[model samples]
Target: MQTDSKWGIYEPEKACPNDWDLFQSYCYYFSVDESNWTDSKSSCQNQESMLAEVVSTEQLAFLTTKAGEYGSKFYFLGGSDIVTEGEWIWTTSRTNFTVTNWTPSAPSDDKGKENCLEMRKGAGYQWNDVHCDKNKTYICQRPLL
Candidate 1:
């Protein structure tokens, strides 16, 4: 079976490369300290990356857990409503991934006129909708080989 140790991820042997290869998949992790929804998305694009598009169940769990390490310091994910209300989709793609990390009763309406998606560092770092103007840290990622 593929092992997390092989990539020095389980124990984090050191400051691993931003582009970490795991289970035949390349994972690049980047973060922005703070930015508005649009700005955050733009930043990732400028970096040739987009707000992380988590593709698998394991990947979503891993990312959500890691986000909690920051403790109440919310962070944005790749999902947004830049196109239309109630049409939440990952910034990297048009359709939502099969696995989602949103908490129960979350994303309640486009209330607060939220145009952004941020993670709440609790209960497995689940997701919550927030105003696009709210400042918070964010993650951006891209596949690498």
Candidate 2:
């Protein structure tokens, strides 16, 4: 993969497909329109991909920059507590949360209705928990193929 010296920005390589941005060993798709969490997840699946999984702080930063490039207000993450409250997991990777990059007073689950994760522009692209039904732009990811 043609990545930067810091491995932050990944340029398209011979193996990379069109319309997908390469980052490390993964390819990501950022949606242009807003959709709810469930529908967003479905969209990714339809594209033979899954909602993005932020595996580390570095990856989170990289994702934050990607989301900003789309100029969207918010972007849905692959994490949710729909299965079990307060227990977030990447639906695609089936990985449990270890470290999160929340802005401040985030993941608040205000009024106890929040269950889905999103990176918000207002919060400097930090992850936040919001109601799953709320519409937002989303990111889809899949292994480099």
Best by lDDT: 2
TM-score of 2: 0.85
Model 1 lDDT per residue over 1-145, tens place: 3348667554323332554323325454546368887788888788776777767887876776666644547878888776888777876788764667777977776554876788777646777788888877777776553
**How much lDDT does candidate 1 score?**
0.69
lDDT of each: 0.69, 0.86
Best by TM-score: 2
Candidate 1 positional error at 3, Å: 24
For residues 13-105, write the lDDT of model 2, one tens digit per residue.
655567788888888998998999999999999988899988877778789898788789999989988787778888777889876887788
Model 2, residue 40: distance off in Å is: 0.3
**Per-model RMSD to reference:** 7.1, 6.7
Q: Where is model 1 poorest over a 10-residue stretch in terms of lDDT?
A: 15-24
- Model 2, CA-based lDDT: 0.86
Clash-forming residue pairs, model 1: none
Q: What is the TM-score of each candidate against the true structure?
A: 0.73, 0.85
